[model samples]
Target: MGLPKPLRLKHWQDFQATYQQGKRYRGMYLLLRVLPDPRLNQSRFGIAVSQKVSKKAVVRNRIKRQLRAILLSQRPNLAGGFNVIVVVLPSAVLCKYEHFLRELEQLFKQAGIMNHGH
Candidate 1:
C-alpha cells in the first residue's frame, strides 16, 4: 500500500512545481523540498528514489515503501498545506527503517515544519 490518494503528490507537474519553487532541506541520506500553501487543508508528499540509489527496481521500491511508512506515521503531527518532496540519496540504500524515521524527523525540525496548525 501507498500513501492515501489525497496525501500523495501524483502529478509530474506538481512535482516540478515543488522542486522549482520549494525550499530545500538537506540531510545525510535525504533531501527535502517543501513549499507551504496556506490555501490547502492538508499536506501532500512525493518520494523520489533515483537510479543512482540503486539499479534494481526492487531496491528503489523498497526505499519508497519505507519512506511512505514513515510519512504516514508522522502525518498527524505535521503542519498542513505543505507540498513536500523527499529525494532519496545514494547513502540511503543501506539505511534502516528507524534511521529513515530519525533522519526525516531531524530534517522536518530543521525545516521548521514540526508544529501543528491549520
Candidate 2:
C-alpha cells in the first residue's frame, strides 16, 4: 500500500517540523515523531530511512516499503489529523518485517495515536 500525495509528507521541511514540534517515541528498531495537524482532519505519514541506516538505495527502499505497508494497515486505527514520521535505525536493516510492524505498533500506542479498542 502506498500513501497518496495529500496523505504523505513530501517535503524535508515537513519532516523537520515534525521532528521539532512532534512528540517522540523511541524504539529498538525505529523512531516515531507525531505532530498534530488539525487542519487535515486525517493522518498523513512519512518514512525516513537515512543513509546512515543503510548505504544501499535498495536496502533503504525496502525498509521504506515495509514501513509504508505497516502504516497503511494501521491508518484506520490511528487518530485523525497528524503528521507521523517513521525513522529507521541502522540496526533495522538487519531486522525482520515483523520487528518493524511490532515496533511501529508499540510506538503508535505510546504516542496515543492508535484507537486501542476505544
Candidate 3:
C-alpha cells in the first residue's frame, strides 16, 4: 500500500552502525543521522523515539507515524545506498507537519541525500 517496509532499517545493529559512521543534524524536533550504505543500491531508515522524549505510548506512536510519512513521501528523491536514523527530540510533539517536513528536507539536503532542486 505504501513504499513497503523493505526500505526500513529494523535491526539494532543497523542503527548502531549509522550512529558510528553517519553525519548528524539537529532540527527543531528531531536529530537525523545519515550514513552511506555499503550495499549501494537501496536506502534504509530507522527511527528512535525514547522514553525521555515522551513517556506515553500514544505520543511516541504519533511521532513515529509522522516520521514515517515524511520518509515515505520523500523516498523517491532520497539518495540510494544510505542508512538513516531519525531520533525524535522532546520538542517534536509541538511541531507541525509542515515545519517538520521543512526541517527534514533541509537536513537531508545538507547530508547530500537530496539534491538542491528536489
Which candidate should be chosen as best, given lDDT against the real structure?
A: 1
| TM per prediction | 0.94, 0.93, 0.91
What stretches of model 3 exceed 4 Å from their correct place?
1-3
Q: Weakest 10 consecutive residues, lDDT, candidate 2? A: 1-10
Ranking by TM-score: 1, 2, 3
The models' CA-based lDDT, in order, is 0.91, 0.87, 0.84
lDDT of 3 by residue, 1-118 (tens): 3336778888888888899988988888889999887686778888889998888999888778887899889988888989989888888877778887999998898888894569
> Best candidate, TM-score-wise?
1
Model 2 ranges with Cα > 4 A deviation = none
Candidate 3 achieves a global lDDT of: 0.84
* Candidate 2 local lDDT, 1-118, one digit each (tens): 5887778998889888999999989999899899998798788888889899989999999889888888788878888888998889898989888999888888999988898793
Which order, best to worst by lDDT?
Answer: 1, 2, 3
Candidate 2 global TM-score = 0.93
Quote model 3's TM-score: 0.91
Model 3 residue 24 CA deviation (Å) reads 1.0
lDDT of 1 by residue, 1-118 (tens): 8899989998998899999999999999999999987877888999999999999999999999999999999988788898999999999999999999999998888777787451
